[model samples]
Target: MNQKLKKQDWTVRVLQELERQYSPSRWSHRMSADDVIKAHVKALKEGTEQARDLAQTLLNVPYGEGDGEKLDVYIPKTNSLDVHLVVYLHGGYWQFLSKEESGFMAVPLIDKGVVVVAVGYDIAPKGNMDLMVSQVRRSVVSVVQQYSHISGLYLCGHSAGAHLAAMVLSTDWSQYSITPQIKGAFLVSGIYDLLPILSTYVMEPLKMTEEVAVRNSPSKLVPQLKLSSSSCQIVVAVAENDSPEFRKQSEEYYKALEESGLSVTMEDVANTDHFNIIEQLVDGEYHLTKVHR
Candidate 1:
């Protein structure tokens, strides 16, 4: 079978998994998109003190900020080293969390002696997914411009953040000339392909137009061009205990990247969950050790 054809088949499978598409009411529990968003916003408002403290530290690190969107840069005060600037994009499933919940990201990256940047953006409903990516790219480009010593940059995100990281890097960077210094990217348990979400109307606040969903998918984007092995490091790491749907999504995404002739790597984190996987991400070693290795 053709690789591209196989990908098309994979997309169909994702569509089948989406509840609203196959059956709307029961899946959504008769909740509207607004209802879902409100519930999430309420929970996030009660944030942890640890996250807030870490954000303050990150705000102090010196890195250029872009006016178009809000972001926090965490450059180790120590000075230049052959270090990777690891950018952490927070995931709220394209709706919820801020860079603060993932504050622990800065400590590990800095401990590894890498520069870290945690970007914040207006949540969806006010800004769509495209807007999210645009702001994230702006933040990344801003960092790249000021930090000439960013030996290699790594984009890492969780959940929805994972999706943004993947979408942002899937592009041909030279076209934008945003960074001549990108090393690679690590997308930990990302929803790189949105066919699943598209099957339901729940993602509409993302302003996920049909065209955007198709165009933004990493699996869909890789087939159209030739990318260099050195241009970027691509890794998709998913926890062993994620839902079968997510597991398949992870497999489908990595397989698409590989089949399309992209240099990619996949890791299944042992004994982890959708929420607990990050516990092991900062370890500096693991099955996907090459991410920091």
Candidate 2:
């Protein structure tokens, strides 16, 4: 075979491997996909309840004109103009989940006197990729604008939310007439590239085309140095038991950021699966939680 043909063959094999790797059936252990989902839902429910009980929360605050353009704000007792704001985007593969399911991680941050905003965006099948990205960007802008005295803004997201959070990093803030004072970013178990996703079962509801996939991929859209904040720190983390693709995505993204001369760190949360990785944020002593401090 010619060199070009060998390259093509290699690409085909890699694509096939990605499809197999993304299949939940191949990765899910003792629990089936349905079982994992049920557990996630239950955790979110409990977390939401705990958050409401622990913090002074303002629920369903409108950030944009759309129905899904809403967020839940958890304010700590020490909230002031000088306090930092941690904005979290919940992940449901851009198809499911909501801001309400995000508060479980707020308790620890809130206890440390940080404000937490759980952002909501329109989901897929009904909400296209463009709309979802726009909503997330708008939500961040809304939080920054509303809290004029905020000291620093920290962006954090889990799974699909991490992808959206990364999108915010690449944004041209000049268009919005607001330069966000981004202090740091924590992206947990995110999909940095969308190419592999095209071959995954999750693509059905996402309705992703090659163009759309390329357009929205964060790894593909590196932040322009002039637009990127110099002081902003970044961390990309993956769970120990996360699929090989998930771990590879985080590693690749971290490498991309570092090669671009950005201050970025890569973390492997020990002994965790996809679901519990974000759940571990509730523990202040965890390495993932300590990164915020």
Query: What is the Å distance of residue 61 in model 1 from its true position?
Result: 9.2
Alpha carbon lDDT of each predicted model: 0.63, 0.85
Our tally of clashes for model 2 stands at: 0
Q: Name the regions of candidate 1 deviating beyond 4 angstroms.
A: 1-68, 174-177, 224-230, 282-293
Tens digits of per-residue lDDT for model 1, 1-293: 69999999987776656652323112233255456445434433333233344333446333334332655665555655666777878766676677555545555455556666777766778777677777776677777776777777788887778878776776566755564455777777677678667656557667677788887776676643235334576788887766666677789988887777676788898776555465344444544544555
Alpha-carbon shift of residue 165 in model 1 (angstroms): 1.1
Residue 282 in candidate 1, Cα distance off native in Å: 4.6
Q: After superposition, how far is residue 213 of candidate 2 from its true place, in Å?
A: 0.8
If scored against the real structure, what TM-score would every candidate get? 0.74, 0.91
Instruction: Write candidate 2's Cα lDDT for 207-237 as tens digits.
Output: 8899999999999887652256557899899
Q: How far off is residue 228 in model 1, in Å?
A: 7.2
